[model samples]
Target: MLKSLQNIFRIAELRQRILFTLMMLAVYRVGCHVPTPGVNGQVLASFFEGTQGTLLGMVSAFTGGALQRMTVFALGIMPYISASIILQLLTVVFEPVQRLSKEGEQGRKVITRWTRYGTVLLSVVQGAGIAVGLQSMNVAGDPVVPNQGIGFVILTVFTLTAGTAFIMWIGEQITERGIGNGISLIIFAGIIANMPSAIVNTIRLLRTGAMPPVTMIFILVLMVLVIMAIVFMERAQRRVPIHYAKRVVGMRNLGGQSSHLPLKINMSGVIPPIFASSIIMFPATVANFVHVEWVQKLAGMMTPSHWLYNVFFVAFIVFFCYFYTAVTFNPVDVAENVKNQGGYIPGVRPGKATSDYLDVVLSRLTFAGAIYVSVVCVLPTMLIGQLNVPFYFGGTSLLIVVGVGMDTASQIESHLISRSYEGFMRGASIKGRRG
Candidate 1:
C-alpha cells in the first residue's frame, strides 16, 4: 500500500489530477462555511438540533451540515442532482429528450445544457421556499430570518442559485481536469467531513456513560461488517460469456475470440435509494412550512421511523432500481452491438434471442439488487432509532462513500498499472524465498 501511494505521486499527470480534485473539494468545503445573508445563525442552528430525524436533517447531512448553518451552499448539490434525475426520467417519456439522448455526444451535451437550466430553476424555487419557511420558523421565540420580506426572499434565492451553479461548474471542472467523478466526489467529501465530529460524539457518549462501551464496540464492528458487505456487493458481477466465430480474411484468422458481458449485481448503484429518499422526503419537507392539520398529519406518517415511510421507501427503491437500470442499460443495444461484431452469447441465438435472455437475467439481478438496497437503507434507521446514536452513520451515506471510494481507487490503480507500476493488489505469484 505504501509503495502504491508512492507510485501514484511518481506519475506526474495522475499526481496533478489528484491535487486538482483535492483543491476543488477544499473550495467546496470553504463555501459551506459562508453564511447566507439575513439569517440568525444561532437560532437556525438551534432549530436544526431538533430536526435530526427529519428530511431536513438528511439534506443537511448531504450538504456537510451547511443547511443547519444556512451557509451560501446550504442547498448543496441537490438541486443539480434533482434536475439530472428529472431529465433522466423525462428521456423515457418525452420523444424529444429520447431523440436527444440518442444523438451521441452532441445530443448528450444538449441534454446536459437543459439539465443545467433545470438545476437553476429548481435552485430558485427551493431557495425561495426555504427563505419563506425560515421567515415563519422560530427557536425559543427568536425568528430564524431577522428581517423577512420579498427582498430577503429574492436575495436568498439568488445567493443559493448562484452557489449551486458555482458548485456545478466546480464539479464539471474536476471531471474534465481531475481524477474520479466530480459530483460523486463532492457528495462523498460532504458526508465524510462529519466523520470526525461523529467520532467525537461517540467518544463523549462512551465517557459520560450515556452509551455502553460494549454497545459502542458492537456498533463499530457492525459498521465494519456493513462496509465489507457493501464492497463485496459493489464488486459482484454476473458474467455472460460470448463467443465470436472465426473469420478467414485472405488466409489469416481475424475474428475468433471469447469474452463475457459483465452485468453488475447492482446496476443502479445508489440511485434508487437517493430517488426514493428524495420522493419520500418531499411531502414532509413541504409540510414543515404548512400548518394545515391534514398536511401535518400526513407529514407525521411519512417520518423516517414510520411504517408507511419504510414501506414507501422500499417500494420506491425497488421501482427505481428497475427504472434506472432500464434507462442506463439497453440489452437490445448490447445484443445488436455484439451481433454486429459477429459475437453471440453462448447457447443463445443472436439478435432478439440474445436480447430476451439478457433482459430476463437483468430482471432477476435487479430484483435482488433492490432487496439489497432496501435492507441497507432501512436497517440503519432501525439501528439509529433503537440505539439513539449520535450521528447518521449508514444507509445512503455509507453506500455513496463505499461506491465512490472504490471507484476512485480503481481509477488510481488503472493509472499506476498503465505506468507499469505495481498496483494496490499484487496478483502475480512470487518465487520461493530460497529460490
Candidate 2:
C-alpha cells in the first residue's frame, strides 16, 4: 500500500487530481462553517445538541452538522440529489423525459440541463422555506432569530440558494477535473470530516462515565467489522455469461467470443438509503414548521425509532433498488444491442427470450441486493444508532464513504497501471469494465 501511494505522487497528473479534489473539499468544509445571515448558530447548535433520534438529526449527520449550524451550505448537496432523482423518476413516468433519455449524447445534455434547473428551483424553495421557518425557532427561552423578520428572511433565502448553486458548481468542477463521482465524494467528505470530533466525544463520554468504557470499546470493534463487511459486499457481484456468434469479416474472423455482465450485489449503491431518508425526513421537516398538535404528533410518529419508520424504510429501499436498477440498466436495450451484434446468452434465444432471461436473472439478483441493503441499513441504523450514545453509525454515511473511496482508489490504480506502474494490490490489480 505504501509503495503504491509513493508511486501515485510520482504520476504528476494523478497527484494533481487528488490535490484538486482535496482543495474543493476543503472549500466545502469552510463553507459549512460560514453561517447564513439572520440566524443564531449558537442557539441552533444548542437546540440540536442531543437531539439525534429525529429525522433532521439523522440528515445532519450526513451534512456534517451544517444544517444545524445554518451555514451557507446548510442545504448541502441534497437539492442536487433530489433533482437527479426527480429527473430519473420523470424518465420512467413521462414521455418527453423518456425520449430525451434515449437521444444519446444530445439527450443526455438536455436532461443534465433540466436537472441543473431543477436543482436551482429546489434550492430556492428549500431556502425560502427555511428562511420563513427560522422565525419560529427557539432554543431554551431564546428565539433562534431574535431579530428583524421579512427583510432578513429574503436576504437569507437568496444567500442560501446562491450557496447551493456554488456547491453544485464546485461538484461539477470536481467531476470534470478531480476524482470519483463528485457529489458522492462531497457527502463522503462531510461524513469523514466529523470523525475526529465524534471520536473525541466518545472518549470524553468514556472518561466521564456517560457511557460505559466497555460499550465504547464494543462499538469501536463493531464499527471495524461493519466497515469490512461493507467493503466485502460492495465488491461482490454475479457475472452473467454473454456469447457472440462467429462472424467472417471480409475473409477474416471478427466476433466470436464470450463475456459476462457483472451485476453488483448492491446495484443501487447508497441511493436507496438516501431516497428513503429524504422521503422520511421531508414530512418531519414540514411538521417542525407547522404548529398543530396532531401535526407534531404525526411528525414524532415518523421518527426513526418508530416501527413503521423501519418497515417503510426497508420497503422503500427494496422498491427503489428494483426501480432504479431497471431504469439505469434496461434489459430490453441490452438484449436488442446484443442481438444486433449477433450475441446471445448461450442457450437463450436472441431477442425476446434473452430479454426475459435477463429480467429473471436481474429480478433474483435485485432481491439479493435489496436484502443486503436492508440488513446493512437496518442493523446500524435501527439497532445501533438508537442507543443515544453519541456514536454516529450513520450507516449510509459509512456506505458512501467506503463505496466512493473504493471507486476512486480503483480509478487511481487504473491510472497507475495505464502508466505501467504497480497498483496497491500488486498482482491482484482491480478493474472495472463499462456496465
Q: What lDDT would each prediction earn against the true structure?
A: 0.87, 0.82
Off by over 4 Å in 2: 421-435
Model 1 sits at a Cα RMSD from the real structure of: 5.2
Give per-residue CA lDDT, model 2, range 232-292, as digits (tens): 8888898989888899989789778999888887888888888777767666776777778
lDDT for model 1: 0.87
Q: Which candidate is the best by TM-score?
A: 1
- For residues 307-393, write the lDDT of model 1, one tens digit per residue: 888898899999999999999999999999999999998889999999999999999999989888888888877677677787776
TM-score of each: 0.94, 0.93
RMSD of 2: 5.0
Q: Identify the candidate with maximal lDDT.
A: 1
TM-score of 2: 0.93
